[model samples]
Target: MDTKKPYLAIILIQSIYAGMFLLSKAAFDGGMNSFVFVFYRQAAATIFLVPLALFVEWKSLPPLSFVTFCKVFLLSLFGITLSLDINGVALVYTSATLGAATTNCLPVITFFLALLLGMEALRLKTSAGIAKLTGILTCMAGVLTLAFFKGPHFKLFCLHHSHTADTAAASSSLTWVKGCFLMLTSVTFWALWLVLQGPVLKSYPSKLLFTALQCFLTSFQSFGIAIALVRDPYEWRLGWNVRLVAVAYCGVVVTGVTYYLQSWVIEKKGPVFLAMSTPLNLVFTMLCSAFLLCEFTSLGSVVGGLLLIIGLYSVLWGKTKEQRLLNEKCVSTGVNKQGTELTVVTT
Candidate 1:
């Protein structure tokens, strides 16, 4: 039962993310301003998390220096603020399915970024290295397929299409291309955040405080971005509607709750294990978008999504194999050293 906890936690986290995609898409479709939505979402997260973080971690919190604060501020600016703002716009132009499918490239992106940052080595002779390379290529192929192709749209169990003929007609190829690139950019920032977070955490080791500070800072940053772009006061108002629900759910559940849950899962099972479950979020989002949102699924999306999933698993497999080999080598070396010490003592 203890062993299964991490798996269960990850599945729950993915389900929550699936809900986020659906609700966010619904909110966007209902004519909510994406920038304002990001602002409100971060604000809500701040409201929910700040008190909790203070209550839990205040006593044991490390001293936050000015440099660390600056790091957190910049991290929040790029990672949470820009990523969410751009992703919200991308969701408006594309289906929620595509948004989820694009996220499957995160592991590959992170790997590539790690290699670029000199945090990881590339050795083509090894099977693990070859697998990682293949995964990167496969993921890129998936992204290209998703961006260019929209083959054979199929409705799944919907009596009527949610989009009107005129509305569907208004969606041009340029918009699709724009949305694809925006989503990719958002994912890239997110992957960078994930990569850089390791060092930031080491410097300021209070995980709860770190997360809360980011949320707090992002609330303000998103607000500035929102107020600048969204001039109308009406766009900032949240009524008793799906938009409000989306904001609350994304802020409280997706941002606040999932962060804690993810930390627990990562601690228990390691990051690679958690990353391997990301496809479940995509699958759940695709199914929910089809059934609830009545969104049409294209064959290209299906094909591209399959490719992304394959690439994700391939990368995860390589990472896992590499870690296993490293552990074995360390164990062998320790055993040899122990034997040598024993022989010296015997002599």
Candidate 2:
């Protein structure tokens, strides 16, 4: 696997997520129920991924075990249900700026979790460790810049529905403390899920099938939640509206494509690597908002984004360098080298 490919995948995924944020904000403004939207998104993702899984992993499909299904179910619950569904609820109660700032916590959360689980080492004395830490913190700073600073409106192109999201922002219902806690809950579980998925993917090793299974499971789970909250069947009705469009876009692009990409990245790079890529979405959001929504491109946002890129690259370079050194050591010591990690010590 080319080292650059995962980075490209993550960057592209981040850009898509940033654009999705704007589009979904518009849909939310148009009075779409978050729960219903989640159900639709999951349903759509299942529809898209199932076929791919069937065709690609058809021959190599691992036999389904109860334990594997259970792991996949837990993944669906945490990754989709808590991360996204609860995240939507948190966004409603919080300001976008606040949400953005806290959402940057994912990398930090995953970093600590991975370290504690022995999946990552904190060799603070090493240059690689220092670079990784710096990059993680730099990404967070970039998020802060995005959250707090909106410079003069220098954007040339603007979306037609930008005003809708603007109106939604204006009419936001903010409960700062409550929103912060809820946002924390969402990101914490999301980060947790990312870390846990590594082991699960190792055991499964069927990326598409696993992703599709998670989406398929989430579709049902979200539907049940929707039924509990929205007793009215009519509320769940789909129409040719922004809500429908948002669901379709989220289902196909956000869930279907990004899930597979994320799984592959996690399987290859580990959780911290995946977490590091998340803050890039904030950078994407700033640029997308400026260009597509005619929002001002703040100097702070630009500087922060540049810093974030530098930091992210620094981390990637550090990890790559560290991996190379580790592999060389393993080979020299007559230990087993399994790509990014040691398979066994033959001493």
Candidate 3:
């Protein structure tokens, strides 16, 4: 329950997620179909996590109640399948950095959803809450700035094809705008999934098992949809090339390993601290894109990214300070022993 450790862990996770975005973009640039990419990503994530869940939660795993199964299926639908599908599609139309920058607004979306659903109290009068609200708004502004403003572009590969309606949509000048909007929708679905699963997480209390179930369920759902919606293998564009590596990395490392790390961090620190790590993703993405993917940055993008990170840090700092004070006060009052306090902090 060392407060600082959670911050570090979250930063690490964010870096992984950001790198995943760049990798995803590369796969798209190679003409990989979004649906097929998601299908494979989920398939790989499921493969990686299934054995881990079996080993860890084997004895403790409860029999799958119909209700529990349905909830998990729904979580898979919104959080896993839909989010990945939309994000993958959107990335084909947008720059990697812009696609990732939009995700910085997820925390704000989650907070508002919590308030609307009565999961959290609207303590507008409190300085801590006010600071958090301001931070969220500022971060959102940064995301919008990145989306609407074309900072600069150094095109390395100018891809063109026989123009069709789909190609037209994908190659539209406002690709960033559409991508940002789609990413926002993905965030909304992801946030709602988190909110809906609060009770499930409490009841299950096994992150690995939940993650496995989610991936497995979502893979099947996505697979079914892919079969129905995508009739041509030519459209799938599956290639055993660099795009294959990108897909594998996203599936195994990004989805599988990152989820485990994120669950562990949340178990140790709490969701707010975990969420604060999101800005670090931007940093990692920028670095990886520039170095690994040969992406060039523009002045406006740099400023917008800095503003997003600053706003994100402000919110996390405020939350950490408030939590630390509460913990100290509890200790002073002997409300709980160090052991109990640690557990509370971990949660």
Off by over 4 Å in 3: 1-12, 152-173, 264-273, 328-347
1-347: candidate 1 lDDT, tens digit per residue: 99888888999999999999999988888889999999999899999999999999878989989999999999999988999999999988888899999999999999999999999887889999999999999999999889899888887775456762234335887898899989999999999998999999999999888989999999999999988999998888899999999999999999877888888988887888889899999999988888788888888899999999999998888888999999999999999999999999999
lDDT of 2: 0.70
lDDT of each candidate versus the true structure = 0.90, 0.70, 0.74
Rank candidates, lDDT, best first: 1, 3, 2
lDDT of 1: 0.90
Compare the candidates by TM-score and give the number of the best one.
1
Which runs in model 1 stand beyond 4 Å of their true positions?
A: 1-3, 159-161, 164-170
Query: Model 3, residue 88: displacement in angstroms?
Result: 1.0
The candidates, ranked best first by TM-score, are 1, 3, 2
Tens digits of per-residue lDDT for model 2 on 1-347? Answer: 59899888888888778767766655665567778878888898889889988998899998888898898898889877867778777656543433444555666556667878998886779998988788677766665554454454244466554553354344422353455567667887888887999888978988778878888899899988888998877778778887888788888988766777887888888756776676677766765655555444445545655655666566666777798899899787664345326434433
What lDDT score is found at residue 125 in candidate 3?
78
lDDT of 1 at 77: 95
Candidate achieving higher lDDT, 2 or 3? 3
| Higher-ranked by TM-score: 2 or 3 | 3
Error of 3 at 307 (Å): 3.0
